[model samples]
Target: MNHAIDSITDGTTYRTGNPEATWRHMRAHAPVHWHEPGLFPGFWSLTRYDEVKAVLRDAETFSSASGILLRPLAQGEDPGSDRTLALSAPARHSALRGAIAQWFAPRNLRLLGEHLDGVAKAVVGDALAAGHVDFVTDVAAGLPVEVVCAFLDIPVADRPDIVAWTTDAFCAGSAEERSLAHLQILDYFGELAEERRARPGDDLVSVLARVRFQGALLPMEDVVLNCDNLLVGGTENVRLAMSGGMLALLEHPAQWAALREDFAHTAPTAVDEILRWTSSATHVMRRATRDVVLGGRQVRAGDRVVCWLASANRDAAHFPDPDTFDVRRTPNRHLALGAGPHYCVGTQLAKLEITAVLREFFTQVGEVAPAGTPERLESIVVNGLRSLPLHLTPRTG
Candidate 1:
């Protein structure tokens, strides 16, 4: 089939700079529309918050069985994979969710808090010293990778390689490039897994190697897939979330000032608000298992649905003023971390990260404002600032 590809419809190509205007246009006219980009079959872009929630919450009707990205990921998945857990629906997703759930709980990461604090302090301090710095690099992007490193017990110094592999593997700009990055990452992981087997360490990988589920320790391939999931789901998205939170603060000075005044209670709310405002990850893809009606539109059994968290977060029907960046926005049930069985595993870690970064930021710098308008992440799956330049006014001592 010659897909009706309006190549320019891709948000990554042109929407990288100003997503709001693009989303606004999407909501206004083509809210549940499709546009092929020659790479894959087009999909329905669900624009309203209720509509997205309807899909995510009701996984049976709108399933992730087809996977999330625009194009089909190569079927090179190692047989014993937690990705089987992640990409499967119903029974498989439930089992996978239960297996990984306790691993990322607050109680599980209790021993990790102190090291995380130190990491946040180091990055925030570096940014402060630079006088002016890219928040994405100095703080946001830097912190999560370290935290993931902490979780995996990888050396802090290995961040460049870890971040790079993930960037290439998951953040590649196109289907063909992503396909290539996938093979490379899987190869790198194969080596890493072999090394961990020979010389084990005190990290998630070692623990995962030992952890049992459904009568036995998971297969080595599952171990690798889980690590890949942690690599993809944990690092950059949280970095972008924190960066987006900072950008929200920069754009809404009142919210920023409020958070500065009361760091304890206010910082957490700011995290939720940022999720509401930014939607760092723009969309998650799902396949329709059966025919259904969403927002009054009939969806065929095999249809692909792109749940636009970007559009959903700003749906006026759900959020009052829908467009305002209100840090204290209450009843904020945004789809930032998604919902149901596949909700993010690193939620607590992410919250702690945003809180820690904001604490160090407000305490040390006093004032932080954007040096330029936000630039979006150049991928459809994740939304973030490619470079968030911020000028932090020094605290009067």
Candidate 2:
């Protein structure tokens, strides 16, 4: 138990130790265990489904403005706090989300869906042509960035740099590297935001540039920060979910066969189950605004509360045989995209991208299997595969 608790703050533990086993131990023994100070700071670790969901739901009591990671922060506050959508208070968060909501609305997503179908087809076709490829880089990594960059009207040439920066920002080994990556992204978007302001276009950046909240244009810093947030959020989880989901399918052949047999009928449920199985976002942190009792533990005001979404998604009390990767899982109320006010704004877009790739694979792929070992990312924040070498056989009529 102490080992598990200690591992909660160590990113390497996610790669070396069986994280599911650790979470299982916590769920069964200490659903709301307090993590003692180590790499970052001591915080309450919430693993059970109900408790995790409760914390996410009560945004008033548990705030996001302070910070949302296990990493140490300057003065215990995120620099983007109260400004960026992901780190803002309720009122500001709502306003910021509303400003860009149209971009991810049903109509926009439907249009993007049509575009993604073509992107997925091309991406999958290329993989099948290669015969052997790293699925993470070749297949899973391409679609989300395509969708996001296209939606934002980012020039195709600049996307590679954007992807590189985003990867470093989220998965870099050192704080300096991560901070530098974030600064680079901010600087890039800051320049783009200015261009969008000069000559507005029908894109996310333009929307951010021109949007007025309370009859005043958004600050430049806010625009860039939100752009950074959307881009990172748009690319990271969807890619991870796709990679992890593909791994799950390969591991569970019967489930893959069942999905292939009736993809249209099963895809919706399959996407949800994949999201649950991957739980790519891993955990989200919130600051307790007031002292609250959680799982028989008294959490103090200003205390950091970490809700383990990955653990919650695997709790047997919520989902029967939670460890099993069932594509057809129904009644799956997963907190993968999160819950309540801070729910992922790009939920519809993510599903469309995932479904598009799976549909394309089903259409073009015949036999698919691992070519080499799959390498998992060693990050406490992101549950992702860094690489997955795969061999693909084209479908035969």
Candidate 3:
């Protein structure tokens, strides 16, 4: 599946055998190349580290309000129709972000340590009980959804449906199917929002329901959209990161041994390395607010700029031996979670989830080996495994 460097069809899949080569080629020859119209529309591709950061940091110049995906809006859609932080004006985005910031702040996330520990124990315990499992669904996807449910105070019975809705919304599906899933999400969250309004709890929904934005409660649309964002972000990113992280460790036995040796000292750096090495967020799009010169290429107003975060994380200029998977790597400031204004809001939560799960996994499970071929999700946005069959070997005294 070696795609042409100039083909718009290249965007169909995250990689083509060796994606690094494709990125390297673009970084060297076409750092700010134009990807002609295809499934979506023509856009500029930024492959270098500095170039990607430049666009992300200069949000005023390259806006997200228009939308982040390269695809044009469906009929009757406005610039801020979504109203999520990823698709809202700075002022609106600030209010929404501030409302949820307290819940995800490091201090607040620490309070969930015991709860996360229990979730991790159960996830790994089930795998241990089974002896073999689909690590993607069984192990990687557990803690993320559980943590979200805990925050939203969603009941255990309802968690599975929410997870299914989010998974279908993001993973492989037809546009109509995806739209129906999204609508179902909005309907479910909308009903929950009303419930919170009636009897306010300490969860996110209640906060959003009561919290004043611009001296008034947040509109139902914004609340639903942002909640949708949180659910999708909460479930998808860390789930993929964990699945990808495990795959990375399995592929690199030395790194796995290092993680198993001293998780406390090594987990932090290893997690950062995992985020960098398995850059699950392949790319994000930004629309140029006005004419701007980027990496020697001229970007006009309303022009789409595709920042390849995955490529930037592997840029040779910033990272030495960028392709190698080294868990001990330091000063690893990767753009995997993004940077500046539109940087992922669920970052701290993700860090906590990844660290806890990885620590517990290494501590409980003795060794992991591939039982069958892992199937990658066929998505341009999501770099994740749909199924990862693994044979587990538990620790024995």
Candidate 4:
């Protein structure tokens, strides 16, 4: 059967196409539909909540060793496929994730929150003081990179280039540009890893440089690749989520008022709702390790399967009024950060960043209105805003 949507593999389709409508139609008619090869490889698309959750949970059945994005790998292989955390097999993935998990753990976040609160105040205050600002670049993009760089202990002098390289690595216009950016990041981290080896600090790169896996220190290649992983993942997800959440609030005035009225009480649920509404990490791909029947369709061994997290977050069967932007949404078990073992390592950090900024916005800003057209990123992998201009009015006594 012909799907109503344009090719999901094409980046331009995400920039211009109406994917939400198509995802809705597919959820009802074809939850486990297959797309013939087009711009990328052929793959099974899962749109429903249950199906997507199940695939993410059973990583042994649906492996991440093939790579996560929909992009075609060179010669059908990724060099970091089973070595890096995001693309590793379950056994090694556990060890790799455990090495740096302490930094993102609850105790660490509690200490980190104090600093992030201050950062949030400064970031939001600057935007409010500006009167009118591009929320995407001026407000949303600043905090996540700062937090991530702090974890990596990146020097203040080097951050500008790091931020630019990260943007190119994930959202560049061409494949060559993205690859070049990746190489630059890997090289930068490689040099940093060498320094950390000689004189380890308390930062994440130092931990990676010193940590052992399988009774041996991790290889320099894994150290550098994981650093690239942390940088890209840490920066992109929260940046897009913040921008999308702000746009959602601007569009829904009543919800905004409700949040601003009692931010302390409302912030927790609001952050989750924002995550669900934004669904920044759009989809994750896995390769089937065994033939299995899913959603009344047979998936063969080695076939690629793409689970649309954005679509699952909006599946009507799980979420009541799935499309509505409600801030106080409870029992919201959205798959925005994913599910099961491969759940986002930076889940707590993402929440803290969103909550920090929103809290300051609610307390300090009396009004926020869209000032211009919002430009979205042209990528199927990330639901992101390139620019969101907004007019802000600071609260006055």
Per-prediction CA RMSD (Å): 4.0, 2.0, 2.4, 1.9
lDDT at 291, model 4: 99
Residue runs of model 4 more than 4 Å from their true location after superposition: 1-3, 73-75, 167-182
TM-score for each model: 0.84, 0.95, 0.93, 0.94
* Residue 168 in model 1: lDDT: 59
Q: Any residue pairs clashing in model 2, and if so which? A: none
Per residue, candidate 4 scores C-alpha lDDT tens digits across 1-397 of: 2646545556666777877888898899989998887766789999999999999999999999869878764356766787788898888888888888899999999998889999899999999989999887788877888899999999999998898887677657688998899899999999999999899999999998987877998889888988888888888899899989989988898998898888889889999999999999999999999999999999999999999999999999999999998999988999999997889999999999999998888878887788989988888889878788899999888
| Best of the candidates, lDDT | 4
Question: Worst 10-residue stretch by lDDT in candidate 2?
Answer: 70-79
The lDDT per prediction is: 0.72, 0.88, 0.82, 0.88
Indicate the TM-score of model 4: 0.94
Error in Å for residue 209 of model 3: 2.5
Residue 186 CA displacement from its true place in model 1, Å: 3.7
Which of the two candidates, 1 or 3, achieves a greater TM-score against the reference? 3
Cα lDDT of model 1 overall?
A: 0.72
lDDT for 117 in candidate 2 is 95
Q: Candidate 4's C-alpha lDDT?
A: 0.88
Question: Compared with the true structure, what per-residue lDDT tens digits does model 2 show for residues 249-312?
Answer: 9999999999999999999999999999999998999999999999999999988999999999
